[model samples]
Target: MLEKIKRRIEKHQAQPIGEQRTFAVFLPLVKVDEEWHVLYEVRSNHISQPGETSFPGGAVEEGESFEEAAVRETMEELNVSKESIEVYGEIDFIFNQSHHIRCFVGELKHINPDQLQPNEEVASVFTIPLRYLKENEPEYHTVTLKTEYNHDFPFELISNGKKYKFGKRKHKVPFYRLPNQFLWGFTADFTHRFIEIISEDTNFLEGKNEK
Candidate 1:
């Protein structure tokens, strides 16, 4: 199944797409009980956005492709070798009010969770069942915030068993969650959309098989 997904993804890469600002998020996978688990990272406190649960990824660098940046960032952040990860299909493109993000799923044949290097920007690594995300209603919260260009917009955050409230300042506004790991901002939005796409695809395949 993983190999099939990989082939599907590779086929999509051949098509030319419009030029737009894009970033990549990696959905790392591991197998357990013949099912897949998705890996996520808890951002370290030393970083600007501390304690946020996010995929190991970042902005695409100048002169670098999105796939290159995804693979590079994942390797750097998780200490996972590039050779071991198999590229699966991409998630839908998320258009943030500020920028756009492209997400990809990748499979890791052998993952050493204990060897995950906590970079100054990454506190820890964690995994949750892909099936859980497919089935559950993720909690959401409202956040109002100003962009870097000084524009205010209403934002949303997906709560991961964390408490949060809305707060504002003269220049900035945010949804302040209790000082623990909560998935919010672009990361949360990307994650939610990714799961939605995967669920739809899985259902479609199931229906086809039933026929």
Candidate 2:
């Protein structure tokens, strides 16, 4: 039994239980006239969530690492080569009940946004200065997530039955107002958190920029 357990554990990768969808996004930093900017993509009209502003990324493929997925998606969406991207590091990740997103930060070298023809999944690409993002604040919306039990739930089997008092959670949905774009949802949340870590809460970005 011990040997069997060891084998099974060695083969198992830690992941959330039940149905889960994993994703990856690359935050591309482009240096323009000595200022750093972050690139974003507008989803194509034919794709899901068309007109929404998001980073260049997509789902993680089988047998691919999260970093590789980010690079592949960026190349596909932006029509760039892997050599053009210099991945600084992985910053933070985001997750929900059914979705897990891994994020990576990188710099795009020697590429003009206007010159590249994005794939069908991307309608257009735009960039915003990182300094502006660090200087501003994002508006937040709080939402409560309440669990709903199925009618056939076996409450009798648990110590807490119908009156078991399942816990409810509160989530903060962040919204960032751009000049001509409405950046919100998980995209906005990730950006906001990134800025907070490097600028507001920590001096990481500043330190990185100095060197």
Candidate with the greatest TM-score versus the true structure: 2
**Candidate 2 per-residue lDDT over residues 1-211, each given as its tens digit:** 9999999999999977777789999989887777778888989898999999999988999999999999999998899999999898887788767898998988899987768799999888888888888877789999998999889999999996788988899888888878888688888878887777677535555545652
- The parts of candidate 1 lying over 4 Å away from their true place are 1-22, 32-34, 144-181, 201-211
Model 2, global lDDT: 0.86
TM-score of each: 0.64, 0.82
Structure candidate 1, residue pairs in collision? none
Best lDDT among the predictions, by candidate number: 2
Q: Which residue pairs overlap in candidate 2's backbone?
A: none
Q: What lDDT is obtained when candidate 1 is compared to the true structure?
A: 0.68
lDDT tens digits, residue span 92-186, model 1: 67763455787888787677665667567788887766666655545665555532322343333445313334345332222213235465556
Least accurate 10 contiguous residues by lDDT in model 1: 169-178
